[model samples]
Target chain A: MENFHIDGSTYIPRIDFNAETGVLEIEGESYHEYTTEFFGPIFSWLEDYLEESGKEITMNFKMSYFNTSSSRRFLEILTLLEEYQNNKEGQVVVNWYYEENDVDMLESGEEYADDVELTFNLLPY
Target chain B: MGYMEHFSVKTFKQQLAMKKISLAFQGIFSQDVLALIGKSLRNTPESRVIAKRLFAIVIEMAQNIHHYSAEKQYSEKDGRDIGVGIVAIAEDDHHYIITSGNCIVKTEVPPLIERANYINGLSPEKLKEFYREQRKAPQREGKPGANLGFIDMVRKSGNPIEINIKEYDETRSFFILSVRVNKELQN
Candidate 1:
């Protein structure tokens, strides 16, 4: 499968999913008006990549800010990863990065960690 | 000329200054406009401290107007229908107040009031639990958002969401929402 990438804008995140390395990264702010439109293709790409490749994947999220709608989509992504890991397709680890003083972001990561059964790491920058 | 006869920019400026409004916008709530407002908040020194909370509240309230406001304007730039509303940010010594107002159908008043009251009554822990529960649920069909905006706003602000509904006409009512964020960071 081909790699997927999109440059981040003021209201959207940078999406870089490398099929060769099995390393997916979503970095920057995500407050786009249409969350589904922005995230739908990425979800499809992840599904295809998981089905096609037997390699382990690491998803890194470095978000400065995201609106409530985007939060739901992030949870959906985590749920998908949890399912992929559960099916024994390949190992999956999520590194959630937040700023050092951003308690809300850290707590958001903690909430997601509690919700999913995947290996989730909270890293502060 | 007729409308301009009574309009006074001086009076408007004075009113804004009196209210301590640092930023204000009254027009269509488009994504581009929101981006500009967000950038302005980030760039302002006084607001930069509370920018995260202020921005989050602005997005939720503005998006509520964008999605559900009764007043709609077709934007040639966006090539879509956008809602019209007013948003303002005021700062005092300790708090930044974010206020947004828009028109809504009169029928939406009761349910909105109920929702606001319910959210205000919840403790912080309950609010978080409610947010998570709603986040896990499937997005409602035909809705543009996940329906967790209000809860999330209150959670982030660490305060109750205040709402006012005033009768605009027989068929429509004006909806106003205000949230306050502390200038100093709080745990």
Candidate 2:
């Protein structure tokens, strides 16, 4: 499968999904207007990738800021990964990175970690 | 209060100035405009925590207006209709007050007031629980705001949302919302 990559902007995150290595990373801020439209293709890509590959996947989230709607989308992504891991398709490891001083981001990561059964790690940068 | 007394532009302007409002904008709340406002807030000299809260609140408030305001404006940049509203940030010794006002259909006042009152009644933990529950639930049809922005603003500010609804005309009312973020960090 081909890789998926989208550059970051002032209000959108950068998406880099490497099909070969199974490393999916989203970094930066996400507060765009068309959140559902923007994430649609990314969700489709993940579903297709998970179906095609049996390799272990690593997901990295290094987000500085994201609005409420984006927060829901992120939770959806984590839930999808949890389901993948639960079904024994392959191992899934999620690394959620936040700035050391951003307590809100840190708390958000903590909450996400609590909401899913996947191997979630909260890393500070 | 009577319609004319609901919002006096001169009095409002004086109140904003007296409250030491640092930034104010009145126009279409397009995504581009929201980004510019975010940039300005980030550049403010407040502590990182306060700045972050301010940024989040501003986005939520502006987006609410963009989605639900009764006033609409066609934006050439966005190639679509956007909401028109007013937003301001004022600072005192202990708090930064973020206020936003927009026109809304008179019929929307009851439900909006109910939602605000419900959110204001919740404790911090309950607010967080409510936020997570609503986030997990499917989006309600035809409701883009989803009340998540309101919950989030209150949760982040750790304060009750103050709302004022005044009849603007026979069919429309003016809705004003203010959220206060303590300058000192809360545990």
lDDT of 1 by residue, A3-122 (tens): 999999999999999998889999999988889998999988988887753479899999999999999999998888888788857788999999887888899999999999988999
lDDT of 2 by residue, A1-125 (tens): 89999999889999999998889999999998768878999999989887753569999999999999899889889888888877757799999999988899999998888888888899999
Write model 1 residue lDDT over B47-144, tens digit each, in one string: 34357778888998888888888999999987899899999999888888899999999988899889989998999989989989999999999988
What is candidate 1's CA lDDT for residue A23?
A: 91
Model 2 residue runs over 4 Å out of place are B1-16
lDDT (CA) per prediction: 0.88, 0.89
DockQ of candidate 1 is 0.71
Task: For each candidate in turn, give its C-alpha RMSD to the true structure in angstroms.
Answer: 1.6, 4.3
What residue runs in model 1 are displaced by over 4 Å at the alpha carbon? Answer: B1-3, B44-49
> What are the per-model DockQ values?
0.71, 0.63
